[model samples]
Target: MTGNPAHRRWLMLAIGTGGQTAMTTVLYGLPSLLPAFQREFGLSLAGAGALVSGPILGILLTMVGWGLVADRRGERFALAAGLLPAAAVLSVAAAVRGATALAVLLVLAGACGASVNSASGRLVIGWFPPHRRGIAMGVRQASQPLGVGLAAAVLPPLAEHAGLPAALGCCALLCAAVGGVVLLLAVDPPRPPETGTVRGPGPYRGGRLWRLHGAAALLCVPQFVVAGFALVFLTTARGWPAATAGTVLAVANLAGAGVRLLAGWWSDRVGSRLRPMRLLALATAAAVLLLALGAAAAPPLGTAALLLATALTVSTNGLHNTAVAEHAGPAWAGRALGVHGLGQHAAIVLVPPLTGALVTAHGFAPAYALAAVFPVAAAALLPGEPAAPAGETAAPSLDAASAAPRTPA
Candidate 1:
C-alpha cells in the first residue's frame, strides 16, 4: 500500500482471488467423489444430496451475520477468525463416521466459509477504484472455478489413492495455511475520497435494490441447479463413468474461469455491467434450454450442450457481483454484498434438496426444465440501466477509515 496503489492492486487481487480459489475448491468440491460416498454410506442419491445441501444451508443461515460483522469489525478479523476454525471443522468432516456427523461438519464448514466471501469481496472492492473494479472482481470471481479445476484435477487421483476423507483433510490443512498467509500479506486499500458522517443514499430507500435482489435470486437458480445436477446427469443418464463426469466438470470450470475474466473485462471497457449482464443472462437461458434438449438427445450432443451451459450459467457470477458492488457503494457495500451473497446462498441451500426430490419423483427432465426458467426470468427482469451507474459509489480510501475493510488475502 505504501508503494503505488496500482501495483498494490494486483497484489490484493492475487490474495483475494487466491483465497477464493482455495476455499471454493475445498467447500464446493464434493461432487467429484459422489460415487464413493454412495458406496461407503450405502445411501440413496437423495441421502447423498445432503453432502451438497449441508454447507449451503449453513451459508444461508450465517452470511448476513458475517456481513454485519464485516460492517462492524472489519474484513481482516472476520476472515482470519473464520479461517482459523475451518481446519477443525474440516478435520471433523474427515473423521466423522456417521452421516449425521458429516452433515454437521459440512454445515459448520459452510458457515465458516460464508465469512470468506463477504470479507473477500469487500477486500477486492476496497483495493480497486470504481472504474477498474469490474475486472478486479471478475478475476476474483475466477477463484471459485479455479478451485473447482484444482479439485477436478487433483481430487480424483487423491481420493483414489488416499480415500476421500484424507483428501478432504489435506484440503482443510491447505485452507488454514493459506488463510494464515493472507492474514499476514493482505492490506486494505486506501479510500479514494473522504466520506462524511452523513447518511448516504441506500438501496433500501428505493425499488432499485429490490429489483436487483429479485434478479440475483432468479439468475442464481440455473447456476446452482446446473452445479447440483450436472455430474449426476452425465454419470447416471449418459452412462459415463464417475471419473468422466469429473473430467467434464473440470473442463466446465476451466471454461467458466475464462468467461469470468471476459465478463469483467467487458464491463471495464464497455462502461456498464447491466448490458453485459443481460447478454450473459440470455446466453445462460439459451444454454439451459439447449442443455435440457441435449439431455434427451445423443450423449455426445448432451455433453457438449451441458458443458456450454455450465460455462455460460456460471459466467454471470462476476457480472452479478460487480453490479451489486457498484450499486451498493462503500457505505453499505458489506451489507449489500452480504445480501447479494445471501441470494446465491439461498438458492444453493434450497435447490439441492428440491432437485433431489424432483429427481426422485417426476425425474430430471422436469428438473432441468424448471431450472432453465430461472435465468430467463432474471433476463426479463433486468433493467436496461443499472441502479448506480456512477454517482452513488463514491468511497473514501480504505486507509483513511477508522476501520478499513481489508480484502481477504
Candidate 2:
C-alpha cells in the first residue's frame, strides 16, 4: 500500500460506480427510447420489445466470460476491454438505420458492458474489509436504480426532440467518458499471495455457494413481478390514473434503492450478510402475500401492499452480492459473482413472460400469490450461519490487507 490507500480505494469505488451507472443506463434505461423506436422504425410492439431486450440477451451470453477475464487478467483490464468496445458499438448503433443492425449493435454493446457487473464487485471485495463490504456493495448495487432513473429522465426527451441517434450518442458518450476515467484511475486491489489459481475449482466444492445462488434466483421472481407489473396492476385493476400510478411506483423505486443501502448497512452491523438477507426474504414473502390479499380485498390496501412488496423485494441484492464475493475469496470472486448474477438474470428474463401469463390466466391476485411463493422458497433455501463452509474462513485472508485502519466512510 502507498500513501492515502483509503483515498485510493474509495476513489476506485467511485470510478467503478460511475462505470456501472453508465452501463446500466444504457442496458436497462434505453427502453425509455422504445416509443421513439416504434415511431421511427414503424416496428411492431414485439419487435420494439426485442430491440430493447437485445442488451440483456448479450449480457447473458457474456457475463461469465467477462468474469473469467477479470479473474485471469485484472478488473481494470476487463473493464477497459468491455467498456471501450461497448462505447464503440453503441456509437455504431447510433449511426445505423436498420432495426436489425441497431439491435445487433446494442447486443454487442451489452455484451461488452457486462464486465462491470462481475469485476466491480470483485474490486470491492479486494479493496474493502468484510465489515465495510456490505454498505460498499449496497452503494454499488444502487447504481441500477440510479441508472434507470437517469435513463427515464433523460432518454425520452432526448429521443423525442433530437432523434434516436442523438439520444444513443449521448449513451455512447457516457460509456466512452467512463471508459476513459477507468483506464486512467482504476487500480486492482492487492491480493494475498496464496489466493489460489485463476482456474481453480473454486468455492463450489461445497453446496453452500450453490444454495446461495438458487436462493438468489428464487428471490428474483418477486422483484421482477413488482418491477414489471405493479404500475399496470394499479392502472388497470385498481382504476388509478396512469400518471398517479407511475408517480407512486417511482417513489417505490426510490424507496427500493434506499432499502438496498439500509440492508447492506444492517448486514455490516450484524456482521453477516446472509442473516439480514434471510430476514429480508421473509419480509418480502410477507409483503407479497399482503399484496395478494389486498388484490383480493381493498384497492387502497393493494396499493400500499404493492409499495411494500416493491421495496422489500430488492433489499437482498447488495447482501447477496457481498456474501457471494466474500464466500468465493479473491481468487474466484469474479467468477462467483458472474454466476450469481447469471442466476438472477435468468429469473429476470423468464419471470415477465411466465408471470404475465399467470396474471392473464388467473389475475393479479394469483400472480402476486405466485410471486410470494418464490420468496418463501428462497427463505427455505437460504443457508444459516451454521451451514457455512469450513473453507469460508480462509477466503477472507485475501482481504487481510484491507483490515488496515483508516477513513470514517
Candidate 3:
C-alpha cells in the first residue's frame, strides 16, 4: 500500500521478533542456568526452580494490565518505560544477597516482560496480512524459545568466564538496548482499537468464550511442563549432566522456533484455523507418549529422539490465538488474548508444582499422563468454524486508514 513495502515489512518483523526475544530471553535464560544459580546461591532444587516460577507468577497476574496500558498509551511508551526499568531492577537484584530480594526482582522482571507482549502481538497482526499471520505470529511466538535457546548457549559461560552477576547484568543491558530500539524505531499501527465497547461476541455474556479459554488453558500444560522441567528431565531421569541437558534443551527450542514460523505461515494461507490445530494436537500427543515411553525404556537415542520430537510436536505454536483473533475480531482481541492467556498461565502456575510433586511421589509417567490431558482438552474446544453474527467473517480487518493491529502478548 506504499513505497517499498517489502523492506518496511521486514523491518516491522524484525522489531516484532526482536522485541519478543528480548523480553522472553530473560525468562528462558534463567531456567537453563539454574544449576549455576543453585551452586552459587546454595539453593535446594525446589528453591532454584522458584527462580523460574517467580517471573511466571508475575506475568500471570499482570497480563491484563499490560494489555490495557498498551491499548491506552501506545506500545512504544508502555514497553520502553517498563522494559528498560525492569532491566535495571533485575541488575540490582543480581547484586543483592537475600532470596527474597531476588524473588521480588524476578517478579518485577515478569511484570515488565508482560507489558512487552501485548504490544508486540498487536504489532505482528498489524504488520503481516491475515493469510501469512500464522508464520509471522509463529516467528513472534518462537521468540520465547529462541531467547531461551540463546541464553542456554551463551549465558553459562558468560557467567562462569565472567561472573553470574555480570552475566545477568548483560541480559539487563540487552533489554535496555531492545527497549530503546523499540521506542526510537518501531512504527505504531495507524488506527486505534475498534469503536464499540463490545469486542467479539461480548465474551463474558456467553459460554463459547469460556469454552475457548478452557481449551487454551489445557493446551498450555505441555508448554509449561516442558519449560519448567525439560532440563530437569534430561538431567535427573536420563542421567545426562545438567549442562548437557541445557544444551540439548536449547537445540530442541531452536527446532521449535522453526516450527512456529512455518505453522504461522501456513495458517495465513489457509483460511480455516482448526485443521492445523487438530493436526498439532495429534502430533503433540504422540510426542508426549513417545517421550514417556523413551523415559520408561531409559535408552540414550530414544530420549534424544523424543526430545527432538517434542520440539517438532510443539512447532504449531499459538495457532489458537490466530483462530481467536480471526473469529473474535480486534475489538475484543487484547482482552480476549489476555483472558485466554490467563487460562494458560493458570496451567503454567499449577502444572509445574503439581507435576513436580507427581514426579516426586508417583513418577514422570504419572506426571506426563496428567500433562497429556491438556492438548486433548484444547483440541475439543476449537469452535467448529461457526457462522459469524450476520455478515461477520473472522479474518482481521482494518477499520480505517489508521486502524491498529491487535496484539496478544
Candidate 4:
C-alpha cells in the first residue's frame, strides 16, 4: 500500500519487527522447549543444551552469505528466500521421530533463517534517516525478546499437554505467516549514487568493524547465558515450580524488550552509538555479578537479580546493531551486518554448552560469574570512532540535530 513517507518508513519498521520476531521465536524459543526435549530424548543437561545451540551453529555457517546476498539483491529477496524454506524445514522437523533428526533439521532451519538477521536490519537502516535510526533499530531489536517471551508464555504448556511437536509446529506456522507478509510488502530504498571509481577496503579489513564485531560477540555471552538456562536454573536450582519459573522469565523478557527500546532512544539522544554500548557493557557486567551473588545467597533475591540482569544484558543489542549499520555505510551495510550476526551467533553456539558444563560441575553462580567477564572485556575492548567509508559524507547526528530548531524554509 502507498502512504506518506513517514508512514511508509514506520510500515517498514513494523514489517521488519514482525519478521525478526518470527525467526527469533524459533531461534531463542528452542531453550524454552528444552526441558520437554530432555525428558523425551533421555538426554543429560549438556545434550539438551545442544538442542538449544544447534540452530545457532547453523546460523553461524550462513549469516555472512545471507548478508552478501542482501547487499547485492536487496532485503526483500534475501528474507523471502530464507524464511519460506526455513519454515518448511522446521515444520517437517516437528514430525521427525528422533531427537537427532529433529536437531539436524533445526540446524538446517537456522541456516535458512539467518537470512532475516542482516536483511531486516539493513532494511531499517535504508528506510529510516540517521536521526531516527537508533529508535528504529531499537524497535527492531525488541522483536527477539518479544519472540522469546511468546515462547516462554506459550510453548512450555503446549509441549506439556500436546507434545514438543505441536509447540514447534506453532513456531513454523508463525514464521511462514511472517514470511508471506515480508514478501508482499518489503521495498528497499533506492541506492545512493556512487561517488568514485576508487574502492576502499572491504568491511573485514577495517579494525573498527572487527572490534565492534568482537565486542558484540563478547557481550552476547551474558544474554545467551540467561536465555539458555534461566528457566531451568529457576526450576532446578532455586526449586521454583516449572510453570512459575517460565512465567517469571517471560515477564523478564517483556521487561528486556522495553529496555531495548529505551536503550535505542537513549543512544539517539547521546549522539554516539559506541558510547552507549560501552556503558551498557558495564551495566551488564554489574548485573551478571549481582545475579551470581544472589543465586548463591538468596532465592528471592536471585529471581529479582535474574530479571534485572536479563534487562541489562539484552539492552545493548539494538545500539550495537545500529552502530554497525552506520559504521558500515550504505554501500556495505548488509555484509557488515552479516559479519556482526556471525559473531553473535557463534557466541550463542559456544556459550550454552560451556555454561551447561559449568552448571553441571559447580552451579549457576559460577556460570554466571564467568559470564560477567565477557561484558567487562567488551567494554574494555570496544573501539572509539569508526572511520568513514571512502568518498562518503558522514551521517548527521540525530541528537545534535534534534537539539537545534530548524528555521522556516
Candidate 5:
C-alpha cells in the first residue's frame, strides 16, 4: 500500500513489530514448554534449562553475520532470507524424535531468525525521523514481550494437551506467516549519499558503543533469569498449576510490553536515552532483590514482586536499541545493532543454565538475589549522558537525507 509518508512509516513500524513477535515466539516459547519437556523426557532442571539457552546461542553465533548482510545489502532482503530458513527449520524440528536433535534444530533456527534483530532496527532508524524514533522503536521493541506473552498464553496449553510437536509447529507457522508479510510489505529506506572525502573512524571504533554493549549484556541477565524460570518456579516451588502460572507470566509479559513503550516515550521527552536506561537498571536491581525477599517470606508477595521485576527489567531494551541505532547512523546501524544484540543474547545464552543450577541447589531466593547484582553493575557501568553525535545534539538529529524518501536499497 502506498500513501502518506507518515502512514508508510507507521506501516513499516507495524511490520517490524510483527516480524519481531513472530521470531521471538519460539525463543521465548521454549521456557513455557520447558516443564513439559522435562516431564516427557525425564530431564534434570539444568538439562531442560539448556533448551532455553540453545536458541540464544544460535542467535549469538549469527547476529554479526546477519548485521553485516543488512549493512551491505538491505533490511528487507535480510529479514526475508532469515525468516524463511528459520521457519523451515522450526517446522522440521517439530517432528524430531530425540531431545538432542530437537535442541540442535532450535539452535539452528535461532541463528536464522537473528536476521530480524539487526535488520528490523535498521529499518526503524532509516525510516523514522530522530525525534519520533524513540516511541516507534519502543513499539517495535514491544514485539519481544508481546511474543513472550503470546507464548506463555498459548504454548503451555498446546504442549500440555497436544504435545511438544504442536507447540513447536505453531511457532513454525508464525515465522512463515510473518516472513511472507515482511517480504510483501517491507521497503528499505534510501541510503545516505557518501561524501568523496576520506571518512573518519567507524562508529564501532569508539568506547561509547562498547560501553553500551557491556551495560546491555549485564542488564539482560535479570531479564533472562526472570523469564526463564518464573513459570517453573510458580508451578514446582509454589504449588501452582501450570496454567495458572502461565497466565500470571503472560500478564506480566503484557504489562512489560506497555512499560517498554512508556520507557521509549520517556527517553524521547527527556532528550537522553541513557538516563532512563540507567534509572531502569537501578530499579531492576531493587525489584529483583525485593522479589528474592518476597519469595522467602510470602508466595503471593513473591509473585507480585516477580511481575514488577519483569516489567522493570525489560523496560530498558527499546531505549538501549534506539540509542545504539542513532549513534551508529543508518550506514552502520545494522552491524552496530548486531553487535549490541550479540552482547544481550550472549547473556541469555549463559544466564539460564547458571540460574537453573542455582535453583536446583539453593532455591529461587538465591537465584534471584544473584540475578540482582548484574543490573546494579549495569547501572554503575552505564555512561553518563551520552555525547551528542557529531554535528548534532544528544536528542536524535533529523537531517534532510534521512528525512527524504527514496527507493529501497
Candidate 6:
C-alpha cells in the first residue's frame, strides 16, 4: 500500500464501498430478477415476494451478531468472513432446483452478508478524521443505490440472455472478488492507544442513542413508502405507461444517490450530523405531505411531489448513520451500528405489507399522508446540537490531519 495517509484511507473506503455494493446487489437487488424467479420456479407473486424477502429476514436476525464480530475481531476479518461465505452460498444457489432450498440459501447468504452493514460503517469511522467522516460515510452509504442500479442494469438481462443460474453466479462472483480484495488489501482502521484506564458503560446507557435509533427507524417508513409506491402511483393512478413510470423512477433513484452525498457534505460543513438530520426530517415531512396533496388533487402536481419526496425521504440516512457511529465511540460503534441497521431493516421489511393494505383500503393520497407522519415524528425525537460524541474531538483542519502519519490497521 502507498505510505501516503490520505491515499491509504480513501483506498480502504473504496474497498469497503465495493464490498458493500456487492452485498447490496445480492441482499436487495435480487428482486430485480423476480420475474425470472417466477418464470423458472413457477412461483406465485406472494411466493416470489417471500423469496426475495428471505435475505432481508436474514439480515434483520443476524446484523447485531455480525456487528459484534466486527467490534471484536476487526473490520477486515468481519467483512471477508461474512462475504466469502455469502458468495459460496450464492454459488450453491445457482445450482439449486427447489424453491425451498433456494430460499434457505438466500437467507443464509443474507445472514452472512449482514456483516457489511455495520463493519463498513465502523471501518469508515475508524479510518477517517471527524470532519471528513460525513462525506466518507456518505460515499459508503451510496453503495446501496449503486448496487441496486447495477443489479437493475445487469441481473435481469443477464438472466434473460444467459440463465437464472448465470445471474446468481454473477452475484456470487462479485461477492467473491470483493471479499478477496478486502482480505488482501483492506486493513482495520487504527484505534487510539488504550490507556490503562477502564472505559465507561456503552452508549446505549444514555437515552440519546436510543432516541436516535427510534427517529431513524421512523424515518425509514416514509423513505420506503416513497420508494415502494412511486412507480405504482405513476402507472396506476396517473395512467402512465409502465415504461415511462420506470424511467422517471430510474432517474429519481440516481438523484437519490446524489442527495446522500450532498447531505453528507452539508453535515460536514455544519459540523454536526444531528442538526442537519433534524432539519432534513422536517423537509421530508413537508415533501411527503405535498405528495399526498398532489396524489389527491392534481396528477401533474403529484408526479412532481413523488420525485421530490423520493429524494427528500432518503436524505437523512447517511447523516443518521454517521451520528450513530460517532456517538457510540470506537469501542461500541460496531454494535451500535448493528442496532441501527436492525431498526432500519425492520422498517424496510414491514413497510411493504402495511402500506400495501393502506393503499388498498384508502388509496394513494391517504397512504402517503399516513406515511408522512413518520418523518414528522422523527423530527420531534431528534436531539438538538449536542456535545461531540465520545472518541471524537472536534476536527482539526484537514491539512493538519493529513500530515499525520497513517496509523497501522
Candidate number achieving the greatest lDDT relative to the actual structure? 5
The lDDT of each candidate is 0.74, 0.79, 0.68, 0.84, 0.86, 0.82
lDDT of 4 by residue, 1-409 (tens): 6656567778888989999999998887788877898888998888888887878988999999999999899889998998899899989988987988988998998999999999999888787767678888999999999889888888898899898889889989998998999889988765665678887876555487789899999988899898879888888978887788788888889999999998888877866788888998999999889989988887778788888997888899998888888777777888989999998888778777777778998989999888999999999889875544587534432222221112221
| Model 2 RMSD, rounded to 1 decimal | 3.8
Candidate 1's TM-score reads 0.90
Write one digit per residue (lDDT tens) for candidate 1, span 1-409: 3766667778878877877777786567765555566776887776777676777777777888887777667777777777768767888788877778888888888888888788788888777765677788889998887787677667766777788787778778867886897789777644435556766667566566667777888887887677767777887888887677777788888889999899988887877777888889988888887777776555677678878877887787777777776666666667877888887777666676678778878766677778888888887887666433366533222222322333432
TM-scores for all candidates: the values are 0.90, 0.85, 0.88, 0.93, 0.96, 0.87
Q: Model 5, which residues run further than 4 Å from truth?
A: 388-393, 397-400, 403-409
Backbone clashes, each candidate = 8, 0, 15, 0, 0, 0
Ranking of candidates on lDDT, top first: 5, 4, 6, 2, 1, 3
Residues 295-378, model 5: lDDT tens digits: 888878888899899788889999889888887777678888999999898777867777788888888998899899999998
Model 6 quality (TM-score): 0.87
Q: What are the per-model C-alpha RMSD values against the true structure?
A: 3.8, 3.8, 3.8, 3.7, 2.4, 3.9
If ranked by TM-score, best first, what sequence of candidates would result?
A: 5, 4, 1, 3, 6, 2
In candidate 5, residue 307 scores what lDDT?
89
Q: Show where candidate 2 strays beyond 4 Å.
A: 1-3, 30-50, 97-99, 160-167, 194-201, 230-250, 292-297, 355-365, 386-399, 402-409
Task: Estimate the overall C-alpha local distance difference test score of candidate 3.
Answer: 0.68
